[model samples]
Target: MSSPSPKSPELSDHSKKYDRQIRLWGEHGQKSLERANICLINATAVGCEVIKNLILPGIGSFTIIDGNIVTEEDLGTNFYVEKEAIGASKSECCMRLLQELNPDVNGDYLDESIDSLLETRSEFFQSFDVVIASNIKEATLKNLSNLLWDYNIPLVYCRSLGFVGSIRLQFREHCVVEPHPDNKPLDLRIENPFTTLKEHLAVSEVNGKSPWVHVIHKHLVEWKKDHEGNPPKTYKEKNQFKEMIRIAMKSDEENHEEAIKAVNTVFESAGKISSNLSAIFNDEACQKLNTKDKNLQFWVIAKSMQDFIKTENNDLLPLQGVVPDMTADTDSYIKLQSIYRQKAMQDAENVYQRCLNTLLNIGMKNEIISENTVRLYCREASGLRFIRGTKIQSEYSDWDKSTTLAEGLECQQPLMELYAVLRAYDHFYTEFGYIPGESYVEPDTPKLKGLVTKLLQDWNIRHPVSDDMVYEICHYGGAEIHSISAFIGASAAQEVIKLLTQQYVPIDNTFLYSGITTETATYKF
Candidate 1:
């Protein structure tokens, strides 16, 4: 396991500040953000907004470039600048404001436009960890894109108009673009064993004596066992409770007996206890409600529960004094405890969504064809202006229809299993757990001999492996998973974090915007 990050002086005082987000991205992700250095080419209003979000998370360092002074209009929309600072240079003002959000960040501001310096300097852009150009002219966009691309540096291109915004991210190579080795798929990491139990408890239409309701019903069973199988607590709490039960139990004492009233009272009391516990478990305080608050309240609760649940080890009474804060009674404790389990499930779902989103968005951000790869191919053969590849074929095949990896490989007719192999390589590095230079099967080699035999039998192609040619096809011909639409920009930023910090693998080359509709398919490069 990787050692924990050294306690940074930049820690926040609040625990709940990012509670919901922390559950999604985890503390390691937050630390990855802390160690990133990002560059903003033009600090426009939209750029400032993106920076505001980035700064709050305390991205490692920022270099902002702009020559324009802040105008009065900026005060209305730019959250980082004040009305009084209208005449000041926007870059410096934004830098100062961002630094106030987190003292750990080191921000630099340039009072001159990016255009003026580019004419005489080529090394200026090389200083940043990642380059993000916001609201720049199209010509400048192309120039910056080319510069970053030539240098193999990751680039983020963004544009905004009114409510609509577009963002693009580019990572130069697979090694730098992929996720960390330790990261796992969000879904697998969060599947819970107690889902059915939690769901049954939450259901209102359950039979009173169902096996699923045992957690609550067991209270009665335990109480009865404690009272020598005679329900002594009910008798002690209320004589009416026991007398009515006794009368109801006898065959000759049922003439106008009010047993229903006694039964209702007992249920009402149990219901109250259940609600109290539910309140505590569902409590906003218990959820650690904010990521901005970095006080680690969840860890505190987890630690306390570790101790509180220990009484069960000694076979001692648990419900008497084992109540969580604010859950004073057994019913409340039970309900809150149930809520806690539900919240755990919710937290896991959120993490899965974040990871899934991040995986897809990385592809959308780098929607450009690999110019370097194209150039390499061009050098091998003269007059190769048009490369007969899957991406180009798909573009001309239908009116924006998605292409499959198998089809792409068929069209290319390469000397190897190009697309399939690339996918395997991508999966191996990102989610399937494989690293380069490690002793194992050839990169992208089938994991099982049975599957290999089956695929070879079906495809009628058998090739011996453990060579570099297979690895190249697997790495390059693979599809990219793209995250599109509303989450485009956020996903771009997430990918940059992974690339810069080497904490997460980049997503496959597939742009999926299922938000508009559940229609998701492949986008090849």
Candidate 2:
């Protein structure tokens, strides 16, 4: 096991330092990034490049394992390795340089190769939150992939060859909270106002401070009480609801734009739960959150919220604890905001203790969850997002579509040809112990031609890959190009930040970057 790291700076410190990013991803996402421990294997130019990005953003810690001695070639691309460090171990060189970027980002390095570590202490792999392995053999990558797969850890397999670079993520499953959705779900609860809100609206006297919002809410409550306590359901009933608002409006209140807007806007299909919330109710994770698993606060809270939705007469998700800016006076708006916020907190607390009982039922220890976690989940309950990713291994075995996939490729879409070559590249390196032309001084077209042909046959693909494409790859001498490595490194680092913070959607299974044309393409298998 790795040694413990110092706690990341507190939220107050985060606000002072990470103010900009906190605005972008919110404090919750910043916390996730700060808590994540990333592991990288082989500190090649690409690996260090990725590490560089994460360190700058203040990831909690990182551990790099590499056994190679730095060479003159390392100085060409790896910014982290200076000329003075040419003879040094690549892992140590990369770590020293990366630490200089962010003192808060604690890290260590292992001088042994990944293969040696895998042989002796494979369980050590389980200690990381995510793994980035670059410039590795296929068998070794697959071993790491499968090991991490079983443990539910995300594995980023990145490669850079010549002008081609690609990153394939092997994640069994991952859930993201901050999708940065364009449309944020709101928990207005307009149709089914809570007891407190209803009681506030029940008064006939507004004391001249009531905003048009309260006027409209009060009018609608009076109408519902006179009727069967249901909001407008049909077209005529909506018209009827509007008429009720119109009647409640005094002649001078006609100029009250808030009242006018509420009449036209507020009553449209107000009673039912949102379609998004309904979809959330159908999610398998919420349904499957039983006694066996109580570790995830989100899931545990979601499970409890599910029960709340079922049992509550409102039949709605919990209060989102938010009130929109209104036309009310300062006191009225603040009062309304406090009501919503306080009710949401009460609802949240009920779910929190309910889920705590669930944790106990699942045999969890005391205080396995915190009230703050429950509060966060409840506040974002309506805006909660779910993502289900396809497994990375699914992409490798689907080569039968290579013909169709290649057909979609316009001539010299280096990206299209790069994927094919990468597959064949894996085959060549595994059998020959080196990339296609890396060991030879001259272009080994014949050797490469045979390998490509064998790879196509194995995949049962008959599509023709131009001979020029094969030669171009061979001309690269199966060597990592500086610009290409840098591109993949930056891209991988961005995705890792997304993966850890989950603020933005991470690239789905595979991303191919071609320096030949400076473009990237995404594919799902």
Candidate 3:
């Protein structure tokens, strides 16, 4: 297709109500959600979070299947149930609150449990595109997993105890995941809630030591620089300063030199104010990322480069492909694409190398940077590639090898270098204090042109570029730290944009975790 179907008109209310979440998922994902018809088998706390997430993304319609009623305990965790709502049907109450979030949603509340529905209305789940079960028993979950599996519907099973949450995704027959080479038992150590909670509460901010406190100092210094007389006192003014830095980073479309300069000025000024302030932005924890693995590096650079693009532009766009109404001859098109395509690949490698070097300088081991265990993604983003003939038998194979551009590629180094520099500032500031060059911008289509410019060069690759090829990495839970969650979400979401937009080579079932260290390994199942 030359262009995506014209987007549905923006709903002002929805835009504001779901502002934060919409910023997370992007418009295309939101559109996928709008076209989605979902089913939730239960309405418990975890399920409620999932529903809230979906509703905020503007799901087209949903069937909430539950027979349970609200209880006093539910009121503590679920936002939907009020004191008056106790004893009312949980699904019904949830539906009402969801409506308040987005009236565009079509909701159906079932006051019957899954067992009852199975007995009387086996087809209850048939209409939904995806089904989520929360507030359900283990046996019920297994049973529903089987049912959803048989019916070819995607099912999400979630449970939470205090601070820890667990989610398992079960898909139907056609869906297959490459299993881990040495299939080990699923890690079932339910984290100790008290220990985790205690750890969170136990941490104290040392003047220049804590990340957030340093940010406070950075903002204060910036305020002092700009406003002259008195510095910020109220939480709101401090917040405004923080926001100003964020907005300044994303306001431009190219690079963020000014943003970088402003942050440095703030950091320098803070140093003069207090010894602790000087220690804040210079924390040892901050390390530049590595680019030897081109993919990782590209992500770092892409984030830094596109911060402004995402903030300034809102259109769903692509960097390369058949331009609308193009009349250039085939030869001319090929020649034009070759120039940009080569540049795209070159750019990817350059960014990757840059990020790699940065990480190494900050302390990441060179061995980890070069190991194939950590995929250096550096091609046009596309879908999770399944091997042409991988059978969906009971046993699964390593599917990562199959999920790539039909033609394999070699690593590009220069692009890696560029990626590292861009990422270093963000990592440095995040560890030290204050927002360095970071910006909060929603991902959009037009920003993708630069990467796709590379894909057009390799026309000989067997895989044809299409929307279905675009991939999205799924995240079910947050990391140990709250701030890390944003980083994780943004990283995963950016990959999805590349996957969907076919701006890079796709990674299949790529799992990225960094709680302890950056450990990346490809798994299928």
Top candidate (TM-score): 2
Between 2 and 3, whose lDDT is larger? 2
lDDT of 1 at 135: 54
- Better structure of 2 and 3 per TM-score: 2
**lDDT of each residue in 67-163, candidate 2, tens digit only:** 9888998888788888898788888888988999988999899999888888899999888989999988877876676678777888888888788
Q: lDDT per model, in order?
A: 0.45, 0.73, 0.42
**Clash pairs detected, candidate 2:** none
Q: Total clashing residue pairs per candidate?
A: 48, 0, 44
In lDDT terms, how accurate is model 2?
0.73
The reply for model 3, stretches above 4 Å from the true place, is 1-28, 173-384, 387-525
Residue 100 of model 2, lDDT score = 93
Tens digit per residue, CA lDDT, model 3, 297-355: 33343332232123422221112121121223344334433443443444344444554
Error of 1 at 517 (Å): 9.8
Q: Write the per-residue lDDT of candidate 1 for residues 68-118, one digit (tens) a residue.
A: 999876665566788878899999998888788877678889888888867
